[model samples]
Target: MHAPPAPPEADMLRDALELAPDARVRPLSREPLGSGSVTGLEVTDPRGTAEPGTRTTGVTYFVDTSRRAVERETGFATGPSEAPDARVWLHPADPHLPALAPVAFADAASVLLARLGLAQSGPPVFVAYRPGRRGVVRVPTATGDAWIKVLPPSRIAQIVGIHSAFAHAGIPLPAIHGWSQDGLLVLAPAAGAPVAEALGDAEALLDEVDALRRRIAAVAVTHEARTGLKRRLDWYASRLGEYDAAFGALERRVRAAWREAAPTTVIHGDLHFGQLFQDDDGRLTGVIDVDTAGIGVPADDTAAFLAHAVASAVLTPAPRDGQVWALARAALRRWDDEAGRAQGFRARAATHLLGHALGAAEMREDERAAALLRAAASVIDQPAGTLGAT
Candidate 1:
């Protein structure tokens, strides 16, 4: 996928910060915070200014430049109400929206990890940064490299609990070494590259996904944990007003095909090739980004895998009619049959693809949403058996 758009006001803000009179403060990454309304521009300073109210281990010299930039660019003051540490700033262009402070929060994550005894003395390297949601960093530890995941404070317990439960269940997840009072979660490095980078033969890929499906099914959640997938679809459809008619038709189709007999299991709500990692030997190494995992229809994971493959193949600049699509059809066939004894599996999968399309549309990614819409149509319009009949 292409990189996220750079914030328009970032260059001027970088020049205005004046953190170091001689050294240049450059923008590292611009992440969208809170529904694309707020933009976070992570900047670096040579003067080594510590962020105000950061009382943790180690010293992080990069100040939260976003706060100052936002206040100056847009006359709204982001007082103490946004966050306890005031680690948030209003969007520079839009006065109403709020975002994470334009500091590499990963630096703070590193310090949090050190206190938890997960890392040693060196500065942490940025592994991934998604503004307003999470910032992941990698730190060198005495044992090996450990990853620090910094997310919202409210979900910390849920994430830690999920990790513990998954580990006890023998699922192939990274070992959770420790967690901090703050929202930082420290984990051992996952074993392989994402499937987007390492696409094995179609057969091997399908086999690996099958293994993951089985592991998810092994987890026994209570009935209260189960939630209907339709609820999620409704949320997306409501947000995409332009696609209301199309989503209405899809909703009807899904309701007609919906079967109460379908077994509910632990499902990765946002399963996709990018979420999957596999070893060089084509074995499923482990699954990352399990924050979205919960109870849902078992076939939902298979649907997600298929939907992502379809979207990627169609949206890429150099699209390929790859064999993975054929394999995806085969995977769907198995779960579809087990759940409803017919094409009910494909129905659920189609519904998910449609939901994805609506989501893309809401993001104003017209081309992407259009591609996903067409992809979903192809699946929904055709008979399930015809998927790989050719």
Candidate 2:
């Protein structure tokens, strides 16, 4: 298990950016894009003229193997220089996400925030940005914090309708303040601490999640959500196999054991502790990021929660790791007991674990990735009622 080699063009892209002689560029995050990757970089300048609090500037680069994709994209600006193996495109002007260019800056973002009757209290902090797909920006308001979700303009109505459906069904989701035709949706802050921080009583957490899932299922939504990790098992295997042959074998085992299930009910397509919030009293207070809420299998939500719990236990620090592991074991035992009755629960859980393994490997967290791979294998190899017997 070693760190993946740095992208061949990272240095070339850094030099092309033309920063101060003393400036340094460090990789912050990486996600797979079309035949290449979208990398987030932290550029630090010793001269101290960078973003507040952190004396570093954040930049995004899209490196693609396809020259046609680079040349045909007229939405974003590209660097003057090019890499030998891949084409490098810069941001603030992401071709796929048109709203990013305006929202990336303060003046432009403030002008957009004005539409919701809110003034920007500080520089917008991008909580998450997935190159061409979507971006979540945290905007500070005088009263409290608000979130601006940037999506493709075509998705605005569909997402707004989903939020409306969830609210009608009495789900504790973030309140939508306002939305624009250009894909910026302003939302009131979600309540309580993330479940990741306040994790306790695994059974109790499961109980709340069960109730939440039932409420979600009752909501009548027309849009059918895409299948979860089971559909991407082959893709994950292919990406991981590029690094090591063992992953190819692991994928074969997973595919042989996996039993695909039909989409039967409405679900929080991406359910994990991070997306859930609990109040001081340790009750489920809010659930954010309904971007994937629609019709899907019930097991997709359960497996998502289980896989993330196991991954967190594996990746987190000592004392917390022990606590999360205990929770995961308890939850796994419960799911294992039900696996006999639930058609594809075990297989779906394994697929989700493998997805996390791929993510860990992509980030060059090889040890964590290997541990997760083992976890996924265990889920598959262990008999129906003995998943957490160890």
Candidate 3:
């Protein structure tokens, strides 16, 4: 059963801080971080949205400079005072999320340590960034790393789906071991460079993920076979009759355009520059995270790309000024060459336009979505034939 909603002020970090023997509870910053900040979901995620759940760990450590204080602050150091077969450790956050206070602080601290290459491994290497407590962990064993990713046994099917999809596609993603009884998904060792750090060597990295994506696409079922949930256009249209109507109209136009182009395989739902990872030796190692993996109109992913490009564009009315074409061309090359040359430049082109149009409209991005619609509208009025035409 799904967990019930939590209280709006359920301050897990403050509670953990108060519970900790020596750690100090610092209040959060009054100003909240913006939506598009480099900070991750932990900071961005507001409190009360989280369900009440406790993860299991045989050990916990409090990070500090003084050994005696660390021992005192971190709990269960081989004494009778330790809970029956349970141990607690005092873990401190280096830079807490000021808006969310203690939790953010701990999360930031952990991320800093991970990026710096500290506690990258331990026996049961699990890193839970819930609220408060620890800042980074360098586990001693791979076993711990595996335990860190434990998931539910029922979701093994989803795990199996991701694993088989990777194997069939011949991509190198994290391996999925069976889940422990506690429902945590055990995973094989992951060794790769973070995608953000790999940006300097983009050309090579793009080629790598492109090849991997095709392999993924190869095993993908067609759109007709993958119905229900929400179609590319339907997602936009459904929201049209609600809080806004622009989204629905845009969805209709994008749908018409999509029908003119045929889609063949499933595309990675969130494929982008940040998704790729590499090894220390500069080898492109794996594609991480495929929970949204499924057969989709390539244009769906394409739309997300366009959204990012436009949103990040330095100038407005990019299409008129020719910048849109320039960026689109670059994205097309990556989609074409790196994306395994799927042979649908014309259809994909139309879909790309449609994707952006529909998305902007749905988002009620009044000006941008309208502009995209006008761009498509300016070029053609009626779609000529059944989709997937040459």
Models 1 onward score TM values of: 0.64, 0.80, 0.42
Candidate 3: tens digits of C-alpha lDDT, residues 1-390: 011232122233334323323333222211111111011111222222233443212222222211121212233322243212122233332122111222123353244334434343423222444222212122343233432332323344564566676667677767754433323333455557765453444346546655766677876433232222233334334333343444445445544534333455776665654456777665667775554567665654554443333333312433443443334335545554333224332333433444455445433455665555444443223231211111
Question: Which regions of candidate 3 deviate over 4 angstroms?
Answer: 1-155, 168-170, 177-183, 188-190, 201-205, 217-232, 240-249, 260-269, 279-283, 294-329, 333-390
Candidate 3 lDDT score at position 101: 22
| Candidate 2 segments exceeding 4 Å error | 2-59, 64-88, 337-342, 383-390
Model 3: how far is 160 from its true place, Å? 2.1
Clashing pairs in 2: none
lDDT string, candidate 1, 264-346, tens digits: 67776667777777878878788888776777666666766777666665554433445555555655554555544342556
**Model 3 score (lDDT):** 0.39
Clashing pairs counted in every model: 0, 0, 33
**lDDT digits (tens) for residues 1-390 of candidate 2:** 445565555665555555566676665555555444566555666564333443335544554443223213532334443322455456656655667778878888788778778878998888987765688888888878879899877778999999999999999999888988777888998888888887888788888888898899999797887554644665666567766666766777777766656678898888888888998777899998888888877777877777878888787787677778777766667665554235566667788887788777767778888888888887766653343333
Off by over 4 Å in 1: 1-103, 116-146, 220-228, 243-251, 260-263, 317-324, 338-344, 384-390
**Alpha carbon lDDT of each predicted model:** 0.56, 0.72, 0.39
**Which 10-residue window in model 3 sums to the lowest lDDT?**
29-38
TM-score of 1: 0.64
